[model samples]
Target chain A: MKIGVIAYRGGNVRSICSALESLGVELLYTAEWEQLRGCAGLIFPGVGAALPAVQDLQRTCLWEKLPTWDRPFLGVCLGMQLLGKESEEGPAPGLGVFSYAVRPFREAPRVIHMGWNAVSPLMQDPLWYGIESPFYVYFVHGYRADVMDCTIAEAVYGERFSAAVRRENFWGVQFHPEKSGEVGFKVLQNFLSICKSYQP
Target chain B: MLAKRIIPCLDVHEGRVVKGIHFQGLREMGDPLSLGLRYEELGADELVYLDISASVEGRKTFLTAVERIASRLRIPFTVGGGVREVADIRALLEAGADKVSLNTAAILRPLLIEEGAALFGRQCIVLAIDVQKEAPALYRVYSHGGRIATDWEVVLWCKEGINRGAGEILLTAIGQDGTRSGFDVQLIRSITSWAKVPVIASGGAGALHHFLEVFREGGADAALAAGLFHEGVLTPYEVKLYLHQYQIPVRL
Candidate 1:
C-alpha cells in the first residue's frame, strides 16, 4: 500500500514507517503527499513540542488540511492532540475534530506521562484489532485529551483520560505504537486495514 | 495517575555505544544494539541515542543503525546528532526511529522545529538542549554538539523549543555529564517551571538517589542516566523500586 507521513522538521518515525514497510507499504513524506492521493493510508506522528509545530503547519497550510483529510488518519501522541479543540501548551489552535480539550497533566504522579500502561477499550474499538485484553502502548506526554464522548480507550496516568479517540474515519492514539512494540504494531496494521476499507 | 518516565541515554559514535565525562572522555563500552535491547528489557521507559560524531555522510548510517535497533525494540527510541533539515526528520522516521531529536539543527535553524512539529506532529520532535553553568547564577545554552556556546539562556531557549513545536525538552548539563553526581537541579527546575512541556533531566546521575533528587527537587518529569545504567551501577527496575518507596509513581 502507498502511505504518507508528515515529516515537517524532525519527525523521525522510523520505528513506525519501518514497521509499515515490513508490511509492504510505500511511505511518502509531507512534501510528497501530493503523490499520495491514491495512496492507501495516512499517519501523523509526533516528536517535539506543540505550539511551534502547529505554527509550521499553518505556515504550510496543513493546519487547515488536518481536519478535512478524507483518508484514514491515525494521529499519535501530539498528533492526536492536534485533533482536539485546543491545547493549553501554546497559542496555536487545534484541528478540533474530536469534541475534546487537550490540556496538561496538572496533578498526577506528575507531568510527562511516560512508560507502558494498560489501555482498555471503552467498547470494541476497531484499532484494538484482535487483542485478547487490555494492551500496553508506550506513552510520553505531559498533556492528554479530555473528550466529552465516551473515550474509545483509556490509560490511568494520574487519572483516566482518553488514550484513543475515534469518530467515523478519524483515529487518535496518545501512545506511540511505533515505539510500543507488538501492540503498537497491531495498531498500525489495524489502521492500514481501516484505510484500505475507507470509502473516501 | 500519569506514570512518571525513566529514560536512559546512550552515546553512540561510529555505530558503537560509548560513554565518558563531559561527553568527551570517549571509551568503548559495549555494542550499541545489545545495550539498547538490554535497556528495553530492563524496563527503561524510553531510550535516546545521541550521535556525538558530526559526520555529514554518516547521517544515513546512523539512520540505518537506528532502524536495525528499532526492528527489535518495542519501546520508544529517539535518535539525534546531525539532523539538520525537514527532510532529515522524514528520513529518520521512515527508517523506523520513533522520534527524531534536534540539537545542532534546531539551534542552527530554529524554524525547523515548527516544520517538524507541524508535519509529523510536535510530539515526535525532541528539542535537546546542552547547558553549562556560565556564571554563578546563570546557565547558558550550548549548541554545535556543545562545543560552541551561544548567548541563548538555557531557560529562554527551552521556552522557545516549546513554542516552536517540540513536545519534549532534553536538558543535558554539559558540565555535569558523566559526573554521576546528579542533574543540575536549579537548571532543570527553572525550565520545568517556565515550560509546561515534559523535561528529561540528563547528566550527573551518580547514585540512584540522584534520580529521585532530580524528579523531586529538580522538578523534572523524567530522569535519564547513562554511565550508571551502563556500568551496572544502576538499573531502571531498581530505580523504579526506589521511586515506589519514595511514593513517586513509576511503572513496576
Candidate 2:
C-alpha cells in the first residue's frame, strides 16, 4: 500500500511510518503536500496545540490539499481536531471536513489524558477486525474532537466521547497509533489494508 | 474515566538497580531488567529509573543499563539523572530508553528541554523536580540530587518545565521521601493545581490509601513509590483492584 502521512511538528509520525514499513507498506512524508499523485491513503498526525498545527499545515499547503484528495485519510489527535471547523485552542480554523468544533473539557480532570484508554468498538464497519473488545490505546490530549455524526467509536474519559470517526473516505482517531501498543499497530495495519482494497 | 497510575521507580547506580533512603546508602536492590519485567506482570502502569547518581562519570554507566532494559522490557520505562544536553537526550533514545528525564541539567540549561523535545519529541522528555519544604507554603527546588538549592520555587520550575517541552513532571518532595508516611497533600495540591502536563507525585507513598489520597484529594495525575513497590509491601495489581473498587480509573 502506498501511504502518505502528514508530518507535523512534535509528532511521531515517523515512528508510525516505520511500523508501517514492517507490514511491507510504502509510506511517504507529505509535510509539503506537493506529491500525492499515486498515494493510496493519507495519515494525518500531529502533536502540540491545535492552532499552531493548523498554521503549519497552511504554511505547507497541506491544509488546502488534504480534503480534496479523494482517498482514505486518517487523522490522529490534533490532526483529527483540525478536521473540524474550529478548535477552542485557537484562531486557525479547522479543515471543516467534519461538522464539529474542538471543545475543551469544561470540568475535565487532567490537562492531558496520557496513558492508555479503554476502546469500545462499534460494529458500523470491520476496521476493528481481529482486535479484541475493550482494547486499550494510548491517548494524550486536552481538547477532544466533538463531531455531529461522523463519530464511530467512543472512549470514556470523565464521560464517553468520540474516539474514532469515519466519514466517506475519511477516518480520524483521537489516539496515537504510533505510541499505542499492539492494538495501535493493528489500527495502522488495518488502515493500510483498507486503503489497498478501497473500492472507491 | 481518567485512570490513576501506579509507577515502580528504580534507582540506578553504576548501571544496576539500587535502593536507599534520602537518596543515599545505595544498596543494590536487584537487576533492573528483572524488576521491570516483574513490575509489568504485577500490572504497573509505568516504570521509572532514576540514575540517582548525578556525577559526570555516571552517564556512561547508566546508558548500558538502560540499553539492556529497553531491549528486554515491553512496558513503558523512564530514565533520569545526569541528562544534560540534547545530545544526551538523543543518546538515551539511542540506548532504547522510552523516556529521558531531566533534573539538574534542565535547571542549568532551560533551552535544552526545548531542544530535546525538538529532537526527540515532547512525549519522550520528562522533567523531574526534587523539592524540599524549607518554609511554610514554600518549596524550593534542589539541584545536585536534592543538595544544592536553586532560588526557583517548585511550582515555577514545573510550569517552566512543561512550557519548555517536558511532557510530564516527576515531582518528588524530599521531605516525604522514604518515610512511608504518605505524600505531601498540600504539595501535591499545589504542584498539580496549575501544572499543565501530567504530574507524577513521588517521594512518599506508604500505602494504597496514600496513593488514593494523592489522586482524589490532592488531584495528582499519577502516584509513584519506590520503597513500597521494591519491598513488595504494596503490589501494583492489588492497588489497581482496590482503586477500581473505589471507582478510581486504573489499568486492570
Candidate 3:
C-alpha cells in the first residue's frame, strides 16, 4: 500500500521517508491533494514551529482537507501538535482534528524535554500491539498536548502529558518512532499494519 | 523520570571508523554503520559520528555513509565535522541525520547557529565546543578540531551559543579526549550549572567509575567516550548495567 507523507515546509521529510521505506512501504512525498488521494495512508511528519507550518499547510490548501480525509493518518512531533485546536508555541490555530490544546512545559527541569524516556499505555490499542508498558522512546520538544479522552498513551517528565492520542482513523505521537530504536521500529510496523487493514 | 544517556562517539575518517590519541595517530576500528549498529545493540543511548578529517581537508561531511548508517538505526544519531552553512545542515538532515553538530562553522560564523535553529528546530542543532586549559583553571575554546585556539572563553561562548539558539552543547575536553583518565569534572560541573541546555560530556573515560562520577558529581545529562569503547576496554552494556546497579537512572 502507498503512504503519502505530507511535504510540509521545514519538516524532516527525508528521515520520515527513510523510516517508512525501511519498513517496505512505498511513499508519496507531496503537498498536492490529488497526489495524496492516491495513497492508502497519510503521515504528517513535522519539526518546525506551528505558525509557519500551519501557514504552509493553509497556503497549499491542505489544512482544510485534513479533517474529512477517510484514511489512516499519523502525525509525528510537531505534526501531532498541529492536530490540536491550537498551540502555545506560536499561539497558532491548528487543524483542530482533535479537541485539545498544545501547551509548553512549565515545570520541567529542562524546557526541551529531550532524550530517551518511557511511555505507558493508557488503554489497550493496536498502536501498543506487542509493545510492553514503560517502553523507551525518543522525545524532543518544548510543547506538549494535554491528556484528553483520545489519549491512548501517556508519559511523565515533570508532569503527565499525552504521549500518543488516537481518534477514529487519526493517530498522533509526540516522539520520533523513526529514531527510538527496536521498540520504536515495532511502533512503525504496527502503524503500517493498521493502515493496511484500514477500510475506507 | 528521564534516564541519563550513554553515548558512543565514532570518529570516522574517509568512511572508516577511526580512533586517535589526542586527535593524532589514527587507528581504524571498523565500518561506521557496523560499529554503530553494534553499539546500539549493546545498549548505547545515542551515537555520535564525527568526520575527523572533513574540516582539515576542507570537504563536506561524508553524507553517503551517514545516510546508509542512519537508515539502519533507530536511535538518535548526530553527525558533525565540516558543517559550515545552513545548506550543509539541511543536506545532513535530508541525508537522515537526526542532529547536526557545529564546531568550526559556528565559531567562524555565529549567525549560522541562529539560522540553523530557525530553519530547523533548536533540537537538531548541537553546538560542539572543543576546549583546552589555557592557564591555571582558565579554559579556552578551540576551533579546527582543537588545533587552533579562539578568543572566546568556554563558559562565555557556551552561554552565547545557547542564547543565540543552540539547543544542546557537546563539550569535548581536549586535555582528556583520548587519555582515558576521567572526565573534566570541574569543567563539566561549572558548565552544567550555568548553561540552560543539556550538556553531553565528551572525552576522558577510562573505568566505569568515570561514567558514575560524570553523572553524579559532574552533573552531566549524558556521558560520551571513544578510545575505551574502540579498544574493547568497555562495552556500552557493561557501563550502563553498572550505572543501573549503582542506582543511577539509565535505560537498561
Best by lDDT: 3
On the 0 to 100 scale, the lDDT of residue B80 in model 3 is 90
lDDT of 3 by residue, A1-200 (tens): 89999997787666667889989999899999998988889999988788989888989779989888898999999999999999988889989899999998987888799998889889888888998788988999999998999999998989999999999999999999988888888988999999999986
Better of 1 and 3 by TM-score: 3
Residue-level lDDT tens digits of model 1 in A1-200: 67888766545566666778877778886644456455677788876667877877777756776677788888888888888888887845788888687888766653457667778788787787787567767787878887457478887776788999988778888988877756777888888888777785
Model 2 Cα displacement at B198 (Å)?
Answer: 3.6
Predictions' DockQ, in order: 0.30, 0.18, 0.71
> By DockQ thresholds, what CAPRI class is model 1?
acceptable
Error of 3 at A63 (Å): 1.1
How well does chain B match by TM-score in each candidate? 0.94, 0.94, 0.95
Evaluation by DockQ, superior candidate among 1 and 2: 1
Q: Which stretches in model 3 have alpha-carbon errors above 4 Å?
A: B54-61, B134-136
lDDT on C-alpha atoms for all candidate structures:
0.79, 0.79, 0.89
Worst 10 residues of 2 chain A by lDDT: A10-19
Alpha carbon lDDT at B147, candidate 2: 86
TM-score versus the correct structure, for each prediction: 0.70, 0.77, 0.95
Residue A48 CA error for candidate 2 (Å)? 3.3
Q: Per-residue alpha-carbon lDDT of model 2 for B76-137, expressed as tens digits?
A: 67888777777777777767666788999889989989998766667778898999998898
Residue-wise lDDT of candidate 1 within B1-252, one digit each (tens)? Answer: 445678888887777778775556789887767888888788787898987665755555677788788777777788888888999888877777767899988888899999998787676788999998978778988887688999789878887888888878898899998677778899888887767577889889888788788888888878888878888887998998899899887766
Highest DockQ: which candidate?
3
lDDT of 2 by residue, A1-200 (tens): 67877777655444455567767887788675666647888888776667667777777777777888787888888888888888888656989888877886655665556777887766465568788787777787777865347888888776667788888998889987765556777888888878988888
